[model samples]
Target chain A: MRIEAGRASRRYWQDLWTYRELLGFLAWRDLSVRYKQTALGVAWAVIRPAFTMLVFIAFRKLAALPPSGVPDAILVLSAVLPWQLFSTAFSEVSGCLVGNANLISKVYFPRFLVPLAAMATSVIDFMVTLAMLALVMAWFGYAPTDKVVMLPLFVVLAACLALGAGVFFAALNVQFRDFRYVVPFVVQAGLFVSPVAFTLGDVPEAWRWLVALNPVTGIIEGFRWCLLGANAPFYPLATLTSVAITLAMFALGVWYFRRTERGFADVI
Target chain B: MSDIVIRAENLGKKYRISHETAQPYRTFRETLAKGFQRRRGSAHQEEEFWALRGVDFEIRRGDVVGVIGRNGAGKSTLLKILSRITEPTTGYVDLNGRVASLLEVGTGFHPELTGRENVYLNGSILGMRREEVRRKFDEIVSFAEVERFIDMPVKRYSSGMYMRLAFSVAAHLEPEILIVDEVLAVGDSAFQKKCLGRMEEVSAGGRTVLFVSHNLGTLLSICDKGILLDAGGCVANGNIRSVVKAYQQKAGSGEDLAPNLIGGPLKSVTFRQVWINGEKLGGSQFSPGEPIQIRVVGNAAEHLPEAVFTLSLYAEGGRLFTVEDRPMTLHQGEFSLQVEIPAGLLRPGDYSLALGARTAAELATPHDWCWGTDLASFELNEVWSANCKRDLHGMINVNARFTRENAPILERAAT
Candidate 1:
């Protein structure tokens, strides 16, 4: 490998692949450390989304919104699962660089893997919650179309959206720790802005486009369509827009992260 | 793909020191304020500080090279660049093989994780693959001697156990090139010996090693090549002995390098000057088996019934032995005392002298009227003899007579 003034080594991506086991170990470490001290352990994964589903069910009843013909609980959950995954992954990715300051400053690896490992931890939590989602569906006697097979694709989309924004913020956090405050504000405010509690159809048609700009909007809608089958709403243009925006954010995140990554060890 | 495993060319690193704030990181408010100031025609209050500049070196496979210098001499910056922990601002470095650096031990260890789990986590952070760690797992655990606590959380282990476990994992790593800095100073003497032995074994296996430490003795024993950095530049490089000699000479000279003789007002006497062999003492080499005289010149403000003079000899910063002359009455005036070390008392090595003076009554207490540590440093060169090998280990040497005796032998009776 050649280390030069202005560019990372040409083998950075190859090194990233070669160090895949590190990615796994780091993610496993976070997961293990996270659960080791907690009273509920991994059960928190299931409990978190389950509690959010309950809150949305009460909101649905109080708002007296039009039903989309599917079970009210399943409707909010399909979107909530993807939304929780995106939010958790985003928060983890954004703050990971500072969180692993010891590793970043002392060792040499593809530093991007630090945030990527955080995403992996969230992905593991999402899997556990997905299992819980299935059990909830069974409890509600709801079985859907073969479209559920395509569910993994939407999951990937949510991951891309999370990683793209997370990487961008993670890099920013390293420079100006002020982003530490900005990140939580973005995640908390994001829940209400995205269609987690209500379907996209509930919004006034004139303001729907603005809501779709969140990038998570299209992925969550796609998730609902995949789970709710023919009864759920599927907007191809909005879904396509979310995919495009997610890809752009992913590219932009990586570009900004790479431009700033070299100085991380020095400043962090 | 020549024999050289690493090469650096004209490397440099520059950091901007902002006078506005001493914090290592900038906050959003400071950045915003700076932006407004830029618009108002105020020049940025920042100075470019080059921690390292125009440095170059190369190392071949199996070369154990030592990097030595005073503090802030760019020793760490140079190592950080070589290890790719940070990038150099100018020039470039090329490495022909995989490199693993241990700038610190247990860098990624989690206190909540058990020792067994941490081994895997720490190994991966140090660039070892899961399969590699798995294969060497037993060896690492046994080497650390924490077999009974492998499943226990590392936070529960004693600090010694932590260091042992950390060092053991590093010792088992098989990177093509290894870089380490000041880690051996943590463990006990026996553990340090084991670590030094392990390092020797690593070098023997033909792996390139770059090491930095303040212990000159350890450096001399392990490194065949040396690079001396002075003020961010390479002053000398080549054979370890000569580079070390150059460093010692540079460190030994200068105005403040002289003996420290300042004392409190409670003292009635003080050593104004010291000499060796009737010459002003300085950093110089001396031969063994020669009568070496250290003379101390001092003045007494009042008469002391019983004044004692003492001199201590130290090797590598550790006191080797001390001698005291018989107490004698002193008049109120200048007085001088001389202590001579007779022949065949010291082995070939480096040493320093500390001078002390006190009344016999004060000698019983820790208070000495006149005291100065490291008043002078000298080296004893090896003198080849017809019957003895040169450079025999230990601090002091003595003369002994060997004789053979003939006697009657007694037979053992079986019962």
Candidate 2:
């Protein structure tokens, strides 16, 4: 009889590929569960950001915040689309490890999939939000720009930034349940810190250097650049900072997640 | 040898058992103070409590090994390490094949999902491919007896149905190594039997199984080898029967649970004051005519003394019952009381027991710590009456008295 194969070193990448089906299954399961027994159904996915955009419109027109070069509605909608996607993705993934503690504790799989699949569910919402974005842009009579081609690139950066930052929080969330309370504050703090409704030009020259350091400044500007077609867009330094920050966060996130993942099952 | 499917050397796991400060830095002051007092130890002095220490073992392919242990033993830690749920603090383990674990059924069950969907969900969790799951779906439903309700959301099913569905999926996944931990206790007797049968089938089909359970009978039936883990370590390993025999010997005779089981203040404080005032009294054993006074003196931390103090005679197979108050009334605290086990009621049998505690509240397990795992058991052996046989042990009674005076003679003469 042939003996069983011995354990191999460095089978992680292949194993990840092989387990793609599980990731698909987990994401699908989450979507199904999220929509199940809901009154408004999937409309909430569209309505959640749509409602947030309304809030931004109020902040602009009623609250006397100036339009950031584009129509108040269009600018707010675009920023909200990305912000909601990132927040939803990050929040879902932050709790993903804890939510799957049972599965994590019982069996072995590429743990990257847990967080990845968590982020995957938000992709559904992201796509839905994209539909809303295109509909709004069409209604607003804004022509498509060449910068639009780079939209997907900035989108990837946004996801990488979220996925990366979310990993550390998720790991810490398990050990310190206080993170649950802290998470909402961080999300809110980030909103004020990012250039969601305002343009980078709105910042005084004195603080532009500081604002440039914020990873989201690059991302939001990248998004605006893509949408507005370089009317005053596409700074190389900002893009570099965005890409660098995204990479740094992704690298740190993966490492921190892997390091803390070893204890997740027990601590969770 | 099947290339030694599992191997471990010097594996150790340390857990910080704490119910205090969340982070390593205890306080803001501590963090700042430590930097100034650099000569002092760091701000975070985490206590290292090791759960598993230098645990080493090897299992060949197709070996069904039972891991036996008392509560707080390292059984779960070992399983967690082998399952790759957590990492060891030191050393390493190597596995030659894919391993699956059923730490509990429905590990990620979404109650809203249909049974059919959950089957796929649970199978995916065990790392089974969809095609593999689809192939086994029919068998799984049939085994779980949930075929008719497979399309319905699991939340609607009885808990029994949920457990069966969950277990069936795990069973059909067919991983190379399966680790089971106390999941058999979920379903009822028939389902447990079915699960045991399925476990046998899997091992027979050549997959290695590692099982942890408190039920000795179940372990003895399924496993060919046994490993007994004690407090944070393995005390015995090897043949199942021999190890089980050694365990039984270690257990000794299950008797004499006085202080450990019963929690209440005895006649201690204020007895001198009350004894002189004729208010307090204490005694161990009392005759039927004697007034037995027992004053329970104890204080409960959070819970009030709300359980009924049951004074009863138990003989033969069950508890012969009596109670002074409803269980809800007795909370936790220092309390003492008077109890009377009515004279001549106890038919002699070994019944050594003192009052423990049980609440109507739902406890996780019978052996769950709050329930008090092994309570007091006392022995009772005394002759009550000639006609009263030992066979009648349910409720006890001494002697029913009947007297015939001179007036009865006239009535007897007429008959």
Candidate 3:
């Protein structure tokens, strides 16, 4: 192996690809350890979004809010699936670097793998939540149109947005621990603002564009459109904006992560 | 000649040494206060410390190189730079073929994971491919001798078992170059011996190995070449014997004679120097059945009404044998203490002396007034005499007198 200093060295990405097996092992370790001691086991993954869906359903019923013409449970579950994935990915990825300080300080691998593998656990949890969403749709006697085939693309888009935000925060979290406190607030606040409980149509027409800035806003709505059928509004411009924002954040996140990657061992 | 497997030229690593203690996750209030302090020009100053500087070396294939240094002597920094855990501030190193570094055993082993899982995890962390780990899995499991509990979580394993499992995985790693740092210090002596045997086997297989350790005997025995680091620079690089000898000489030179004063000067007393047989002690070697006199010199800023001076002798394995603890009142200014050891009291082995002083006021508390650890070291060798031979059994020597029962009395031997 040839070792060199500086950020522009070409071996970094190649090293990442070379160490792909480590990424899989780390992700497996995280998934196995996550539910090891808990009584609920993997049920905790579904319990979180299930509880949130119920609370949102009650709130919608009490407020007598105008329904988006889809079953409230199905609507809430579809949006919650993608939103939970984003939130979990964000939180887990942001803390991954610091959480695995022992591995980072002692070993040589692409530092990006830590956060990327951590995000993999969140992806597994997203899969479990997706299964629960399918069951919820079945219980409500809702049949998805052929548009549901696009659900995977929306999930990928959400993952991209989460990973971008995660990589950015994971790197920042190492330098300034203040992000440890900042990330939770962002995740919690993001849940309310990203249209998880209600559709984007519930918001005023002028403010809909503002909501599109949340990167996940387009993803969650796209999920509702795909699963809840064509009646669910698909704002082409808003989705484009969200996709652009997600890609930009991902680019910036990867750039910032790589830029600061070398100093991680020293600072962390 | 074998190919040069590793070559490092002018490698330097600079670290920012902050005067303040490192705290993880500082609260916003502290950060804000520090920011304000920085704006007002009262920020804590940081100095650039070069952990490694201009370190140049080459190791050919199949070379077992030992790295020797005192603490903070950049031994670990060089290993870290070589392992690529940390980048050098300047220069570069060319390493041929796959490189695996075992900076510490079980680098990524999760406590909750089973022994089998951890073995694979640790192997991959050390740069082994999954297929390779699988092929070597049974060998690792058998070598670790934890087959019965392979499925059990490692948290349930004894520390020795954990270390063995971790070391076995690392040892089985077939990387062309292996960099190990002080891992043999763990585990019991038997396990340590096993690890040494494994390392010897690896070197015999004609692979490059870079070993960093404080155990000079083991390092000298296993390695053909040695690199000595002192203050972030390569001081000696040659055959293991001479480099180890130079390192030993440097360590024994009494350059750090002044006792590290604990707390502040106001507490009470501080040790200045220790002497043996009217000469300043500097880790000198001695022989068994020899009389020795030790003198401790120190300063007492204020009169100590009730001070207890204690001298402790420690064996190589850190077994403490208190030689003396005398209570004496010391007036202000310099004070000297003398202790005598009789002949045949110490066996043939290495020992260290620790000096400490405590006051009556602090006797009930746990803290000591002033203390110095490893102040001096001396080795005792076995010597033969006309009448009797030196004993070579244990750390202590006992002079026993015997008389025959129900028989004619024998003449006493000359003293």
The best candidate in terms of DockQ: 1
Candidate 2's TM-score reads: 0.73
Compute each candidate's TM-score over C-alphas: 0.86, 0.73, 0.81
State the DockQ, from 0 to 1, for candidate 2: 0.24
Q: Which of the two candidates, 1 or 2, achieves a greater DockQ against the reference?
A: 1
What TM-score does chain A reach in every model? 0.97, 0.91, 0.96
Better of 1 and 2 by lDDT: 1
Worst 10 residues of 3 chain B by lDDT: B384-393
Q: After the best TM-score superposition of candidate 3, give how far the Cα of residue A163 lies from its true spot, in angstroms.
A: 0.5
Best of the two (1, 3) by lDDT = 1
- Report DockQ per prediction, comma-separated: 0.66, 0.24, 0.58
Candidate 3 displacement at residue B181 in angstroms: 1.3
Which candidate comes out best when scored by lDDT? 1
Once fitted onto the true fold, the runs of candidate 2 whose alpha carbons sit more than 4 angstroms away are: A1-9, A63-70, A203-207, A230-232, B1-3, B19-39, B42-46, B253-415
- Where model 3 places Cα greater than 4 Å from the true spot, the runs are A7-9, B24-44, B255-415
What would the per-residue lDDT of candidate 3 be over residues B222-330, giving only the tens digit for each residue?
Answer: 8999999999999999898678667756765654354442333336688777776665654566766577788888889888777788787766434447754656778
Tens-place lDDT digits, model 1, residues B1-415:
4898889899899988889887878998999999999999899998998988888888999999999887788898888888888999999888989899999988899999999999999998898888999999999999888999999999999999999999888888899999998787667767878888899999999999999976666787789999999888888999988887787767655433333344443377766666666655545667676878777777788898887777888665356788887888989999888788886787777667777767765555664466666556566777835333334556666566887669857788987
How does chain A of candidate 1 score by TM-score against the true chain A? 0.97
TM-score ranking from best candidate downward: 1, 3, 2
DockQ of 1: 0.66
Query: Which portions of model 1 show Cα errors greater than 4 Å?
Result: B257-283, B290-343, B351-378, B384-393, B399-415
